[model samples]
Target: MNNLNTLIADYFKDSIYLLIENAIDIHNNAINKPNDIYLSGKLMAYVEVLSLLQMQAQAFSIPLESLKLDKFEAEKDLLSSRIISKEEIIKT
Candidate 1:
């Protein structure tokens, strides 16, 4: 894989991991509601969609431009771990 391809690949892989982590966190928090509440149908659907998306992503790769349009990246901090961080634009 070339530089751009590698970047795009890393972006996709890291993105999926981030999505799962976020979903789990949100789901855990949601289930913590009072009165033994469960996850909403909408959130369940969202997880299903993410599952399908991951399955599809495993087989196919999209263009970097498309990923750029969505603007997600695995930025590393002092913790040195991959995470979906907001993009910062520096106007020069």
Candidate 2:
């Protein structure tokens, strides 16, 4: 039973990583285009999904530290900075 639980945890962790990667990709495209409402909406949806996943994981007592969410957050911050820079350029 312990081994089975480990397997299930590993599977969910892998799925979370995939979801995070997809969200990063969506964020990249959204930043590059800056005008595509659809991509922005999709990114928003991904964020919601990820949030729910994290909440569910916590509810199940899963250790979230292993998820490496900081990397995702750093990437998101970088992308957000690019968007801000572009907006500033456009405004100036």
Candidate 3:
């Protein structure tokens, strides 16, 4: 189940990025003047879709962030210990 959720989240993220790239490359290039080209209705719709996906992904990632924080703290502790021991050896 977790793997499926991760797969879905990754897919959503990829889709959102591709949609943004397409909007910038295709629609944004259609205008001769730089400021004249605006987001078309289709682009706006894609943005809305992206927003919804982002919200869902954030919700799903809350616990993942907590897990990452725990791992980072453990790594820091290990590095701190190693550094202290090396400094002590150098001093001796």
Candidate 4:
């Protein structure tokens, strides 16, 4: 039973790391191609996924301080600034 519990914890930890890595890659792509709305949308989706994952991790008593969620939030904010609103697009 103890070994099973350890495996579960390790799985969640690995998942969190994988999610963070994917998010970073998406963020970089969004930064490089600011005009690509698809990449921006993908990044936003990753942010939401990470947020939910964080909540689930908390439920599992996983330590989140080392996750660097704040950095992802900052990256999201940066991408948001580059996004043009529908109104602006219409005006142009």
Colliding pairs, model 3? none
Give per-residue lDDT, candidate 2, residue 9: 73
lDDT of 3 by residue, 1-92 (tens): 99998888687545544554454443334332334435345445544554454455467775423222222222232213122222221121
Runs of candidate 2 with Cα error greater than 4 angstroms are 57-62, 70-92
Pick by lDDT: 2 or 4, better one: 2
Model 2, 10-32: lDDT tens per residue?
A: 88767766666677677778888
Model 3 clashing-pair count: 0
Higher-lDDT candidate among 2 and 3?
A: 2
- Give the C-alpha lDDT of model 4: 0.61
Provide the clashing-pair count of each candidate structure: 0, 0, 0, 0
Model 3: residue 64 alpha-carbon error in angstroms = 14
How big is the positional error of residue 12 in model 3, measured in Å on the Cα after superposition? Answer: 1.5
Output the number of the TM-score-best candidate.
2
The candidate with the higher TM-score, 2 or 3, is 2
* Candidate 4 weakest lDDT stretch, 10 residues: 83-92
Which residue pairs show collisions in model 1?
Answer: none
| Candidate 3, superposed: residue stretches over 4 Å from native | 30-39, 51-92
Evaluated at residue 55, the lDDT of candidate 1 is 47
